[model samples]
Target: MDRFELFHLGWDDLWASQLAESSHAGRLGRISRVERGECDVLIEMGRVRAQSDSQRAQSAVAPVTGDWVTVTENDDGESMIEMVLERRTELVRRDPGERETQQPLSANVDVVFLVHGFDRPFRAGKLERFLVLAWNAGATPVVVLTKSDLARSEQRNELPAVVAAVAPGVEVVVSSIESREGLDRIEELLTPHRTGTMLGESGAGKSSLVNALLNTEVQETQEVRRSDAKGRHTTITRDLLVLPGSGILIDTPGIRAVGLWDAQDALENVFSDILDTAADCKFRDCAHDAEPACAVRDAVEDDRIDFRRLERFRAMAAELHESEQRVIERDRSSRSGRSHNGGKRRR
Candidate 1:
């Protein structure tokens, strides 16, 4: 394979420019998988194992699957990742635990499948959060409702309409691995050279969907709890695989919590109906809760919109506000500490 053809792996002129500063002898490759600062990169020559210095990788940026990086050979002839090219797009969420930081999930993605299963209770609020996360990543968000075979006919029919209401301007595809449904639509989204990732909770049939797409049992699958329909964490690591004759796909570990990180604009975009309704309220800052002349409340009262969805939208708005405040406080504290340390040094 020619070196230039390597660009088919989501590389572009932007990446080429970013790599120009690095050693001219380095080869460009996309990270297929990353584990403990070690990477499996796909280059023009094929797959190669490259080691990334943990300290340096952390200092620059931890490599994630789908990241295009430049690899160089050391004196020992071992491949080492020298630099991570700038990502055209990346999915990031609030860091898990007590830290107020952003955790990048994947980079340079074109489409994001926000998978949810009918086997479990479908929470519009949670799905809205996932949509915001995908939109915030600068990638097109497509809602994938899986396990359709488990749902009754009425539910199976209504679920798509309900999801479509919440996710305006986004595609909602239903899939049932048991019956081989919606696989074609999924394949349609995976255009050549385009990179996509699946983000969903456990038991959402992400692994099963990928397996169906590849026409092979490449990813392991497990059954969810019989009583609750909650699935165990099957895919623990994020892996990027190239489709046999199509685009690249990345399957990520199930995320238990969906936290919003600087996604205010995305929140507005997701709940645009509510925002538009709120605009007609008498009070400019109507909370839409028992406030007189509130168009949003009126719509709910008149059954123009589902009350549950309106409530969920309000809750997400509150969460976004709180997240923004926390980020502000954290930044202020960091600046204060820096100023104090600088003063001590002057003394």
Candidate 2:
């Protein structure tokens, strides 16, 4: 194994220790792209196609791009992913097809770029949801507003402040491929040995940003529709690329359906002002809706919190509660079915 590739790909002693403890006797490789039945894994010998039967492996989820896995050869001499090392961080969202299932987007992600374009109206709900996703993954989130050349002068000066209000304490960088504004700031966020990925809907200029960061036009670029400013899905799969003299970057397909899974603490992080104000509420479990002595409501009246933002937070919290209830019910039913298979124990 070349020592440089390990560190270059963000592998360290922690991952080394995990590989040492694995029962499978094979080398470590990172999954660059996950296909239907196979994965493109980067090993010392370079990228190779390996069959994946790892959905039931130790990780218990199908390996996604950026997962460091153990690759072993089978009796037929075909490389197989025997196990996926315990992940350090994972970008996850609820499966669009399954109600209660979680879909792991990327494994071991260090930074998540929440890309948006100035061509379209700013969507705070989408930004908040993406923030929750990044926070839940234990990754730093950066709001990258692209197409600076096209933004009106007011948007250039005033839009960033508006975005800053939505993403408090998160870095917001305005970038343009033509003008090359704020590109250096975005590049500096990813130091060597870190892995970052971008998330946004179609026509958000995510791939263009990736091309800029890579210093070459590797990703295909497209123009958005004039009427709606919506772009087609140009980038289809997720692939990891090492930046020149910098860190590793994983580019993913446009994510239009960003269904949040289990993200209570992350949601709190997104609306930290609300969380802090709720701390002073008269009741510990105050819902802040018409509740007497509600510090949150008081703050809204005092202009400390925007009423619309408060309403959005309330709606998201209610949705999260519903999701929790569904999870508990599903777990109880699964347990009941298991007990019927001769392992029944009466309380």
Scored by TM-score, the top model is 2
lDDT of 1 by residue, 194-310 (tens): 899998998788988888888899999999989998889999889887776677889888887777888888888998888898899999989998678999988888888789888
lDDT of 2 by residue, 188-261 (tens): 88785789999998999988888888889988889889999998998889988877777888888887768788
lDDT of 1 at 84: 83
- Once superposed on the true structure, which residue ranges of model 2 sit more than 4 Å away at CA? 1-4, 54-59, 341-347
Which whole-number lDDT from 0 to 100 does residue 268 have in model 2? 98
**Backbone collision tally, model 1:** 0
Please tell me which predicted candidate would have the highest lDDT against the true structure: 2
